[model samples]
Target: MDSPSRRPDRTISAMPQHTPPAPVVNDPATTPSALRRHLARWPTGVAVVTTVVDGRPVGKTINSFHSTSLQPPLVGWCVDHGSSQLDDWLAADGFVVHVLSADQIPLATHFANRSADRFAGIEWTAGLDGMPLLVADVPLRLECRVRHRLPVGDHTYLVGQVVDLTAGPAIPLVLQR
Candidate 1:
């Protein structure tokens, strides 16, 4: 047996050294350009939110449509701040959310154009509160009244309370960046 004082001391240099990992770049994703590009990568269902103002129809193609609640039957979507029809939608008594079918890509494109007449040559019928409901073969339709409006960044978040709904067997249109 070796005496405690006789034991050889282990050199600190013999121990392994761990280097710290490089710090991650704190690039914020909330920037408008970054958000748009990043969010574009995610696929989303397509829809056209329509409302009537002063006896005329107005609508825009939207991919932000989503359900928020079921007990009170709530749904939501966002309109860009630059949209000219924002006031119409905000003042509308109600609006219709027409979930486009997979074959309705042309319709979506038409609505997406800012300078185009969206309702021109399109078939639609007046629904609750005279809101125009696209007559195309959509998979689902929701008639909703304005429930809430929130200003978020460069868009207005519009929450609606569902008043009426219809569903069909058509396949829903999906869009991706």
Candidate 2:
């Protein structure tokens, strides 16, 4: 697979990184921010969720991808209510979830950005039902058809049945945030 950095992918200017003070666990007052900080200690596998939007490929970087069931081969991920791609994702018939490798940080960052043309010059191909799949040596790729959508709290939970699966890279990409 071609590297996005070597090609003409949208680049997001790096923002300054600062570590906030961790909240006291013993304290009774646990704010939302504190809860977030506490959970950031546990890293998750980074995933890039891709689907077609009006004949063009669109993707979003996510760390919320997880297995739902084994009996029916179900998987799930969440999208924030405020995400611009929420409507497109919710309406998509099928999608591809590319679990990134550690070396695919560039791809993850590209999809996470707010750029309208995330796939500009990025190598990709069509999967099941014309769903877009990134041309990367990822850890795992699941071609899924939408099975359920449950709106809960600030994000909508999307569940799908895995119609196809592939594996490539060895090292999985994990991040605290």
Candidate 3:
């Protein structure tokens, strides 16, 4: 049975028919400008990447997660080079991805704030890999083990082996910036 607190479903049945078509602006010399144009057209969901780092909860807001391989059940995300949370996550062998519900805006905001100790006063449990499991009410969660790390440009690319997954039909939080 679904939890009583879960948000009522308000999903759209079909894609809006009033959307405009993409414009074609092909210019090899303007690739950099064109790339920025393309990036502005894509939308992505947001999530908080969390784990226990040296017995302390470490988390950061990210929108870079994506499935990499289904055969091996792999997922990946990129962490910026200058993030203080990056060092902590690099030390952790595993971590949890908390797919926050729309109602978790405050939780997301807390983690995004540079001055806030996001985990303080928040209830959580240790996962199988010693990663911190968020206590917030959400529809989906994933626990994954770090399988590989590749440095790309100014970020660290992490490939995680999905160890577990859970879903409960909850609405996901989205990021527009």
Candidate 4:
């Protein structure tokens, strides 16, 4: 028989074949389950630290925050040592803390993510210290000037002297394992 329709329209029906490679674990390292267990045991509070750089607002969710000294109105928090945003924060004169209320867990999670526009849909006002203030429901707020910083562990300990503060009637959020 003559070759069927080889002029213009010809069909070659064939199945695409691929090799199935063998599955093997070359390096067995810690898995997500292991990390989850470790992180789960550590409880921390959620605070949104806000500041302005070049007339723009920059904020991040941080749990590693505490009062350093009451006499000088100093407070401290740890930021990842190699964070790209460090330059802006270090250069900025001051920052504000928005102590999330018990019902504002969603706000904490949103700010904590490594995404764009953390201030979107959040009501805030610029404070005298050139920091952003929580205009809505926040249990506490502190505007502080960067006093000192020390490298400790995997983060930079930023100690700030309180320049101004404002507190709301909302309840403070507490995190626990």
Candidate lDDT values, in order? 0.90, 0.89, 0.80, 0.81
Q: Which stretches of candidate 2 lie over 4 Å from their true place?
A: 1-30
Question: What would the C-alpha RMSD of candidate 2 be, to one decimal place?
Answer: 15.4
Which run of 10 residues does model 4 get worst, by summed lDDT? 27-36
Clashing pairs in 1: none
Instruction: Indicate the residue-level lDDT of 22 in model 4.
Output: 70
RMSD of each: 11.1, 15.4, 10.7, 20.2
Show the colliding residue pairs in model 4: none
Q: By descending TM-score, how would the candidates be arranged?
A: 1, 2, 3, 4
User: By the lDDT metric, which is better: model 1 or model 3?
Assistant: 1
Best by lDDT: 1
Candidate with the larger TM-score of 2 and 3? 2
Scored against the true structure, residue 175 in model 4 reaches a CA lDDT of 76
- Candidate 1's residue-wise lDDT over 1-177, tens digit each? 989899898666555878987765876666778888889999999999999989989999999999999999999999888888888877887789999999999999999888646888899998998899888889999999998999998788999999999999999999888
Higher-ranked by lDDT: 1 or 2:
1
Poorly placed runs, candidate 3 (over 4 Å): 1-40
Candidate 2 lDDT by residue in tens digits, 96-176: 999999888999999999998888878988888788888878889999999999998889999999999998747999998
